[model samples]
Target chain A: MVPVFLAQWMKEKRSPYMVLIFISISIAAALLFGSNMDIKLKIDTFRGEGVTVEEAERWIDRLNESGAFIFSLRAEEESLADVRQGRSDMAVRLLKDDYRIIAVMESTNVELVQQHMQAVYHEEFRIMAAASHAEDELEFREAMKTYMEQPPLKLQSSTSSGSELRSYDMRLQLLFGFSLFLAMLTVGFRVNAMTAEKISGIWNRVILSPLTKTEMYLGHLTYSTLIGIVQITMVFLLAKYLFGFSLGHSFGMLAMIVVLYTMTIVAMSMLFTGILRTPEQFGAIFTSIVPIMPLISGAYMPPGTITNDVLLFIGQFLPLQHALDALIGVSIYEQGWTDIYLPLAKLLLMAVIFFGVGINLVERRRL
Target chain B: MLETVELSKSFKGKTVVDGVSLYLDQGESVGLLGPNGAGKSTTISMISSLLAPTHGDVLLRGKSVIKHPQDIRRVLGVVPQEIALYEELSAYENLQFFGRIYKLKKTALESKIQEVLEIVGLRERQKELIKTFSGGMKRRINIAAALLHNPQIVIMDEPTVGIDPQSRNHILDTVRYLNLEKGTTVLYTSHYMEEVEQLCKRMYIMDHGKVIASGTKEELGRILSSEDTILLQLDAYDDAFIEEIRSLDPVRQVERTDQGLKLIIAKQSRVLSSIVQSAERHSVQLINMHVHTPSLEDVFLHLTGRTLRD
Candidate 1:
């Protein structure tokens, strides 16, 4: 096993550029995609007949406070034209005491923008109604402002274990998703070298040696898994320290998940190598199939966003889904061992099953 | 010593190798000769334990290798027909890896690699990547890789198939040294009859998945002892003249050659006088006429009616 592993390592040492390129691509892609996650969505806003320009501007300012959706004040004609020309998904028409949404098409963004606007308008209307019963409008306004800042009755959302819930960070999810996705490419290509060796007759020469079949397989797989773990770890460290992305968890937990996820990915790559005939076939199929896993697993969006039963059911079989679940559960939700054991176990089971089936298929086709 | 008993292999009911039985004594160099698709590679694969025979037993020292392949694999070194080294790695690295897998210790492995490199005459270029080498150099390294463990028996399948004469001579010299000086048993296969003639004492000629003949060079040459070959060169000849020559009393077979005609006839027959008379009667010029000695090539042509390269 050591010999076989050393041979693979020597080959990589001679041409280390491929592995370095994969690592660089993983980091570059994560940075490229993660950088866009924080940009606020801009929407055009205009005033109605009962609303003055200053009132509309104030409403726009209030709407921008969440830092999610950006509402910029514009002329009513220009706002309507922006939506009609498809420059914006939706626009806002602020009334004196009511709000209206203008758009040419309905989408998830339109729905989210409308929901946020409704919440703000409902709260303001309730406050106005409460202030109507006061004798002095100015005093009531000042008192309401002070009271809202320091509420006597506060509702804090928490888990059943009494820990505060951490708001989902889409940028972190994108970073993990893109990093894992690219790491799969590196691992899959490394594992596919077995097939390439078989074609080139190197596998037969090794088999003719005194080394057992198990040792040869273990050698190749261990190298692939190690390389994968290293790439993911490097990306995570760079993300946490260099890119200033908050991991929000201990390095030890992240390390454990990286190992398990790398193993599962390596096994998955072996399964793919077994099913395909040639290295070219494996490359084409693996590259085409891997990009869709993050989508089906909801890696680009928050949890519970994918409500389609078929897609959710398919995501259950993918290792990436469980990896993301465990990673996000730890980094964002601050879940402990008990909270993540299921996903971790699922990853281990996948690794075992994939490794077994992959070896069987490879043995069956061995000449 | 090793032997195969009635070894046969089939793929999906199509037999590729059928009932091939051969043996190699200790320190003996034997050659397996055949054309393309003649089951030589298949037989070699079965003997090397790379493939399990459909029906046969390969006995190494009177023990069934099928039941315990490790017995033969430990003592056997196979130089495959393909160049199997890692192209991205240096020659020394390839030898080191193969030697390590054979369980050679580190200190000993380093010396063994250097020794094998010397044997293949590639010690100076040990650090060059395999991809940088020519086809012949690659083949030399391929042989070097198999020799790293110093196995008792070496099986070379077409090791000199496509190479320059210089490399081919070097390889032949290396194989001769391994067999003669080191006393390693060898089972060599090739399309070049002269290579086998130069190296092997005993040879097996196979065709269509069967060994048609096997014996020492003298014994096999005796198969054509009763017959003689005559080469006839003429300035110009017609089919009628060829037919007339074929109809002669001592003629057994007549084949048109590039120059004129070749005839297989009874040994010491007086057919040359009859051929000269026929050529005179047909007004054809006899440019040259010569009697040929029977070689392994002739024996092969007499038995299978095809050249070794066919």
Candidate 2:
């Protein structure tokens, strides 16, 4: 096994460009797509006939409090022109007591902004109504501040494990998504070397050696898995230290997840190698199919965004989706081993099944 | 010593190797001769334990290796027809890897690598990548890789298929040295009859997935010992004259050649005289006439009705 693995390493060392290129692409892609996730969406806000500039400014502050969408007060003509000229996706028209969303197209961002505005306005209106019942304005303000500080009805959200659900970071999702997606390519191509070796007769030469079949497979798979882990680690390290992306404090959990995910991916690649006849066919088909996995698994978007039943059901079978779930559970959610054991177990199970079936197919083809 | 007992293999109910039984004695160089698809590669594969025969057993020193292939794999070195070395790796690196897989000690492996390289005459170019080497050089390295472990038996399957004459001679010399000097039993397979004739003491001639004949070169030639091939160089011979030669009482077979006609007839027969008279009567010029001795090729043709390359 060591010799076989060393042989693979020696081959790669002689021509290290492909592996280096994959790592570079992973990091570059994460830097390109992940950088945008941190910036807040900017929406232009303008005053209506009865709304003063001060009131509109106050409304903008209220809307911006969520830190998700930034609402800026602008001249009515400027805001309307920006939307008309396609400079902005949407604009806000603030009235004295209500707000209107003016836009060229409808999108999730527009709907989310509207919902936030409604919630803010409704809370303010309720506070105003409560103040009207007070004897003096000063007294009303003081009592209202106290009540707001200690609200009577507080809604708390927590997971089934009784842990508070942490805020999800879209940047980390994109970072991990693109990194793991590209890592799959690295590991897959490495695994696909099996077929290439077979075609080149190197595989038969190795078989004729005293090495056992199990050792040969283990050697190849272990090397592939290691290459994948290295690619992922390099991308993550670059993202963390170079780009200043926070991967949470759970370094051990992250490492464990990386190993499991890499192994599962290697096994999955073996299954693909078994299905495809030649290295060329495997490269073409595998490359065409891998890029779609992240999309189906909702790796590009925030969780719960892809509501299609079919896509969701299919995503359930993909190792990437489960891996992302475990990774997010560890990094973003800061969940413990108890919380992530299911996804981790699922990954292990997938590795076993895929490796078993894949090796069988390969051996059958050999016969 | 090793032998296969009625070895056969079938793919999807289509038998590719049928009832192939052969043996190799210790320190003896034997040849398995056949054309493409004659089951030579398959037979070698089965004997090397690379493939499991559908029916039969391979015995290595009186033990069946079919169930325990490790027994044979330890002592067998197979130089596949294809150049199986990693093109991206140097020849030395390829040899090193193969040697390590055979569980050779570090120091021993290093020396063995150099020894094999020296044997194949690629010691100086060992550091060059296999892809950079020419076809013959790659082939020499291919043979060098299989020799690193110094197995008792070496199975070379058409190791000189497409190479320069110089490399071909180098490989033939290497095989001869391995068999004669090192006492390594060899099962050399090739369609090139002359290569087999030059190297192998005993040979198996296979056609249509079966051994058509197996014996020493001279012994196999005896199958046609009673027959002689008559070559007639003619100048515009007519079909009637060919029919006349074919009708001779001693003639067994007559085939038209580009030069003229070839006839298989009884040895010491008077057919050549009869043919000359017939040619004169037909006003055809018999430019030359010669009686050829039967070779192993003739035996193969007599038995299979085709040449070795066909």
Candidate 3:
């Protein structure tokens, strides 16, 4: 078994394929992070009736500090033309009481721009209203100071219940999803070659030794799982450092989920290998499933985002989907182990059962 | 010591191995010879415990290996016909992996790999990937991988098939050394009668899933003891000249030779005069001639009425 493990490890170390996988994922994550970072939350603007350019810039400046919007003042005609040309990401219409946020589509940016605009302007009008009701000169001065200190619209307020620090960071979720997808294909292909080796009589040589069935099976499994874990770690780390994808502050919890998820897919790859005898079958059957697994596993759309019930239902049962859920739950939502253990347990159960059956079938078939 | 008792195997209702019982003593090199599809590999497979016998049992040293296979598995080494190796790995690495699987310690494993690499003559390029090596090089590495464990009994199944003459002889010499100097029990299987004839004291000639004959080279040769072949080298070959020589009295069979005719005749029969007279009558000039002893090929021909290769 040690020979089997060492042999596999040595082969992987000697080959360029793992490096290729890293480079491929790094390129992919780079594209994901780079493109996502370039999104223009900045709205092209104009002075509206009764609203000065100074006031518009003031609101835009406050929203920029919130890391929500980037506003640039333009001529009214030029701003409208930019909006039509899709150059301007959003527009704001300042009215007497409320401000209206506009975009071609109601995207996350649109919602955030609206929230930040409301927060900023809500304070400005509050101070104006306070100045109209001051009792004396000293009182008027005091009122203005009080109104300046207190923001009418509180973006963050103390909730009766605790605020769970959540990460709706799309870039971070793509990091998880893309890494998991590539990991599945990478390890699956490697395991398929291993199955081929088993049938090619090289595996029989090891079997001819004094090793038992369990030891041999475990060796291959452990090696592939270790490979999967390493790949995931590298991809996530690259995303964090190179592309600014954060792990939502729960690095330890995300690490645990990554470990469990790696084991699950490694077992799944073995099961996939055991079901077929040849690479052609893997290419025809298993690889056909590869693209779809990510789709259903939230590698493309993170959990609770897919609109179709049937697709979401399929994702609900997939081990990867639960893994994404658990990953997002702990790292993003600051959910404790108690909150995420069910998903973790499900992933573990899937690993044990799937790997056990896969190992048995492969041993029986080889013998 | 290893022994098989009426071992048989069938696949999909087709019997690839019939009931065959054979044995190898502690230090003897025994050969199992047959043509293609003669079940030689199947029988070897069963004996080495790679495939379970459909019937009967294999015993190592007196205990049934099927009942206590761990004892036999520990000391058994098999050299499969095909080059079973990790093409992506180097020769030293391949040997190291096999040695550790056999549970050799770090120091012993390193030394065994070095020693076996030397035995197969691949020690110079032991670090090169097997895929970069030639076919003959891979074959040598394959043999080297099997010898690292230093097993008591080694079973080689056509280890020299499709190799260059140089590598072929190297492998043959290595097997001889492992058997003679090391006293390792060897169960050698091949269709090449010359290899078996040179290396084995006793042999089993299998044909069509059964052991058709089993005996020493001399003992098997006795099947054709009544006759001997007369070789006549002529200045040139002729068909009708050999035919006329065939009709000569006491010349039982006539076969064309590269330069002349070969006559098979009974011992003590005076056929030299008829063969010489026939060559003179045909205006054929005899270059040289000699009488030769029977070989394993002749024995196979006498018993099966077909050449061992055929």
Task: Note the DockQ of each predicted structure.
Answer: 0.67, 0.64, 0.54
Candidate 3 chain A worst ten-residue window by lDDT: A157-166
Candidate 1, RMSD to the unseen true structure: 3.6
The residue pairs found clashing in candidate 1 are none
Displacement of residue B41 (Cα, Å) in model 2 is 1.1
lDDT of 3 at B297: 72
For candidate 2, report its TM-score: 0.84
Report the first chain's TM-score for all candidates. 0.93, 0.87, 0.72
How are the candidates ranked when ordered by DockQ, highest leading?
1, 2, 3
Better of 1 and 3 by DockQ: 1
lDDT of 2 by residue, A226-280 (tens): 9889889988888889988889888999999999999999999999998989999
Docking class of 1: medium
Clashing pairs in 2: none
* Candidate 3 clash figure, as a count: 1
TM-score of each: 0.90, 0.84, 0.76
- When 2 and 3 are scored with DockQ, the better candidate is 2
Candidate 2 has an lDDT of 0.89
